[model samples]
Target: MTLGEGTHTIIAVAMGVDGQEFPSAPVTFSVRLALPAPQITQPEAGSVQDMNLWIGGTGADYSAQVQLLEDFNHDDYGYSLVTLTGGWGRLFNLAPGVHSIVARQTINGRQGPVGIAHFFKVRPSRLTTVNVEILPSQEVKFSGTGHNGATVVLTYVSGPNNKPLPEVVVANGVWQISAPDWENGIYTYSAIQKVSDNAGGWIPSQDFQFSFPVSTKVPDPTNVRASADYSPIFSGNGVTGATVLIRKQDGTEAAPPAVVVNSFWSSQSRQEWGPTFDQIVQVKQRLDGQESEPGVGVVVRIAPLPPVISSLSDNELSPLIAGTCWSGAVVNLVFSDNPAVHTAAISGTEWQFRRRTEFAPGVPHTVSVTQTAAQQTSAPATRTFEIRRTLLKPVIIDPANGGEAERDLRVRGDRSVAGARMQLRVDGIDTGPATLTNGGLWYIELKGLAFGRRILDAQQTLDGRPSERSDPVVVNVVLMPPQFTTPQPGGDLPRTSTISGTGMPGARVDVWLEGRDDFLLRGYPVDSNGRWSSLVILPVGVKTLQARQAIEQVVSRDSPPLTFNVVPAAPYIETPVKDGHIGGSAVVSGFGVPGDTVSIYLGDTLLGGAPVLEDRTWSVPVTLTQPDGAHVLVAVASLDGFKSDRSAQQPVVLGRYEPSIDSPRAGSWVSHPVTFSGQGRLGTGQLVSWFNPELPWAPNLAVSAQGWHGLSVRALPAGGNWCRFQQTIVDGADASTISDWSESARFEVLDPASR
Candidate 1:
């Protein structure tokens, strides 16, 4: 049976072997074909587009095999196929050209007839460009065209920023939009066009990436000013309707932004002062709230009122000029006919300058003063004055009175009549006379005056007329002190040395050695020509010497103190006489120069050394651990790394230990308890004992490490009133190998109560 496109019901019966017919229940269902509506959604029918085309439509029931047919009904060549899971399908990559497209849907083994056919043309994109213009005012003009009258959208990117402009409809296949109030700089833009209505969304136009730059320079501010109260006003040129901003040198806006008009912008002067300072100010031009580069800067300085001249006067003696100016300005004073320019530093807004040179009497002078600050000089302020007459008196300018004077004494005085004759007197006797020069100075040299305090006076004479004598001056002349030529202060010298210096001729020079009680004087006669030399001996250790010279019964002051040391010539050995016994070390001592180090030697072996003290003495306990024999001991003094000759040799014996019992005589009385004391070489293991059987043996008294030992015994046997002590050398812990005991030292023990 063939099934039609409608609902149907049927039943069947099976014939039994007996030829009987049977009937069963029937089922009903509808038979419908899964046809699809294959209308193209993108690259709408008959629309211009690129070679990349999208063919898509609804599919047949549950599952269908969909294929795009090129040149439908004419061989029906398949261009693309897609397996549709539902009733929808799509295809891509259709050949470029005008073509009729048909989609077929097949389910199972049955294929449905092709759906409604769609037509389209596949070609390269013609939406190739979008042009944008950035005007000097920062306004942007954008335009673009796309094939098939596609819709276009404009967008630009600048400095990592992208912004989309208004969308426009294509008129005659072209679209344009104008954007205003953009910052001046380079910009890159892209035109996004929709060539057809498709689910693929907007596509960027090919070769349509374009860029434009705004080249307008930043507006510059000019004629910036500030009033005395610090109120500020500024103006500048900028794009019309742009906001002009004024800022201080610190980069903070000085006021709210102002709008530009007629290509010029200005801020109204406000009653309130802006940041008032003598500094540069900057302004920036902005378009549509976008800031541009900084413009040129203008300096604003609202200067204070001119400084006041409080005091300006001239005096003949100690001339002074003073005034006040701006707190930080320098005051310069220039005088007429004077090459010296005086400058005064500003202290708390006050300035002053003092002239060291005295102004001539009755002389007219003009002085001008000005202030300089911030590299700008003010107008000159002037003053005129004349020097008044001062007191006229001659002043002595030579050796001061009562002061030391040398030979060729220059007797000079000022305020004398020019070319006048001047007479000089010494000790009431006229020595010489001199004529004053044109500069009112008179001087004369006096010679051959006796050594002693002499009175000097001077008077000026003109045309045989004499003036009153000036005040007298007293001076002393004598021989200078003698100085040492060799051995300077603090120098080391030998005991005998010569001391010399130059002194007055035929004068008596005396040298003095500083002692604890007083300075000891040694008289020596000077040569005829003032040179003196003397030989003197200085004691060892630190000694001080001084010298002075007397001429014509006048003695000069003592010279400076010369302090020095006399190093020792040789070392001295005062202890350990010839053939003396030395246990371990011998005590060697003697006197030497101070600050010397004395080293003691036994034959060729150095024992020890000690530094010399301030009293010129040194002592050393030198070790003598040599073998048992006589040794020659000597000492050498060393000062400042230099060694003196060895002292006289002395003999000493070593390596002999003397052991003896010091307590209890040969026969003596003693208490009931007895004590034994002895001396022996230290570390020799010497032991002491008592050998009276009736008395208890005394405690062993071992020799001390420091050369002395003692022992006491109690509860001695009462019967034996006398006891004897004998010490012996022992070996090891036991009393074996003992040397012969010392001779007996006997003492008797007695009861204290019985006495």
Candidate 2:
């Protein structure tokens, strides 16, 4: 039960086993509210105080004791009790460096919750004569004057608090301590001198504090780099206001000292070296009379040497410019008359660049080359050379050197140099510049040349320079032969056809069959466009034909031979109608031209051939070898050596008619008259025959579509007998169309008494 802040009365009750209640005397008690924790109003948190300090706070209950707890501990040095007056209390004479104090209010053995913790620092007595020194080896020492025979205890206060230092004993009113391996920073320490009080205890005076900075060594230089100039500049980062020094690998100074500004420093060497020079050096910084350790080795490289040209004499217009240079250097070429600058990378010690455009013919040129490496350029190497005039001889393409040509001839040729014009020479007479096309092709037409053998040659000129005359093309200035324009070579033609060609205008074209001295068609006039046609009945054979043109009485050589075939008509297949079935050794008959030969074909396979009779009917025997399936057959007719096109395709079916016996099987016992059954094509008829020793010949039995119960044979010997079947005429036809017999089925025939 919780009690309120007021006076209350409670009664105790006693109960017996009989359920009767007895009441005791009433008890009265007073309930009072707990006093709130105090608030420290004087010497705020984080404030620095002197040795003789007073800490005060406000409280709600003036009659309560304000307990001040130092460093949050209840030990002898921390617990303190003080009486409050007018709701305020003070804690006096608190020793100090840094302190944390919490206050609580207590009344009648009841204490309230602790107040907010307050932290602050107390200023110890300032030591005026304290001396601090950092030795060259980074050791720190502290010394000061204190009371005679007193011992001084040191506690680290701030700045790099690594560990507690050892105590020092004062002798002759002086105390000193040395700390080794001290880092570089400002450090504050509190010193307390303790004297004997003659009661087996010592009294500690107020703290005497001191602070000092130690900087024994400067930092080493970083990020050191050098330029590729003859007198290079070395630069890096270091401590501000430090002097940076450049030194050789042997510890000798290489350049004057440079002061660091804004954490960066650079030093340029006073003396210069050759362009290809390189060296290794170190860098360091010094500040406040202390020097740092040397940095890593830095490489300094100078510019590359000038390149050397190999040679410059060549006949090619776009020649290769090659030279020797330092490995990994860029070689640059600059011409005196050309504005463009070309560059090439050195593969090893050599570099080369091919000019894209040709140099002017027979002109002197001066080219200078230089090598650059490590961001530095070298001096230029000079060379002068002239491009010699050496033009290739032109080549005549048309009007063959020893061939015949027409009087009004067109001369064509090609030049080695592009965009060069050609000049023609006929019979040692010069013809002005001709038409030149892209890709170095040139042509010129000469009209009405003398009707005799003529000499033709040409020369090419470029950029006002002439090339050597070409090898002379000697041609006969006569009428040119006609070229066949119809009935193309390797084509099939009818016996009566027209042949046409092109020749010189108004020329008389004479056409002749090959191997015939006499002309087949004479005096065919060519039209203005050099076209002529002749109608003739060609012989029924493959023939070669040629034509020649004659303007006057002189006839020119024959044209290129044109070969063609005069074919006969395609033959018609009279037998074996479309989609019909044929068996072994079937005869295929067709109708064709009287003297032509007809060849039968099954798919692409040749069957056999037969000549057409005088009555125009032909027949050929073909033994079918293909499996039983549908196939296509075609007929072609040939006369002389020319064959006609294939006739209309006739799709047909082929079958192998050998049948197998399934009942009274091979090697089985059977009675005198046995039934032979087998499987065969549904539309085919089967013929069964047996070899019996008692009979000279066995009769053939025909069965049509009987499936597996097809045939029965009688009169067998009382021993082993063999029987076979073959497909005879399909659809129950006669036996004239029979296939080869199948393998014999051997079976034992039992006599009637032996069954």
lDDT of 1 by residue, 8-33 (tens): 88887888999998877897888875
Among these predicted structures, which one has the highest lDDT? 2
Residue by residue across 1-755, what tens digits does model 2's lDDT show?
89889999999899989999999999999998767878877676766665556577776475577777764574322333443353454336655356677777777778887888887765444344668876433457778887666678888877765547798878997888888867668888777876554447555665555788877567687788988777788898877788887889787887788998878889888888546455888787878877787555788877776889986656478667788998878889988768788897568998887777787654567889988876778889988877764466888999888998877778877755556667788988986556564434667888768788889888877778888989998887777678998779988876667888888877898898899888877888988876888777877877898888888777778898999887887888867865556776688986787898999999899999999997567999999887656678999988877888899898776756666667677789877556666665433444444643223222444555665453344466688777655654444332333444555667888888775
Worst window of 10 by summed lDDT in candidate 1: 731-740
TM-score of each model, in listed order = 0.25, 0.34
Clashes of 1: 3
Error in Å for residue 72 of model 2? 99
Off by over 4 Å in 1: 1-370, 375-424, 428-448, 459-468, 474-502, 505-508, 512-537, 544-546, 550-755
User: Which candidate should be chosen as best, given TM-score against the real structure?
Assistant: 2
Q: List the residue pairs that clash in candidate 2.
A: none
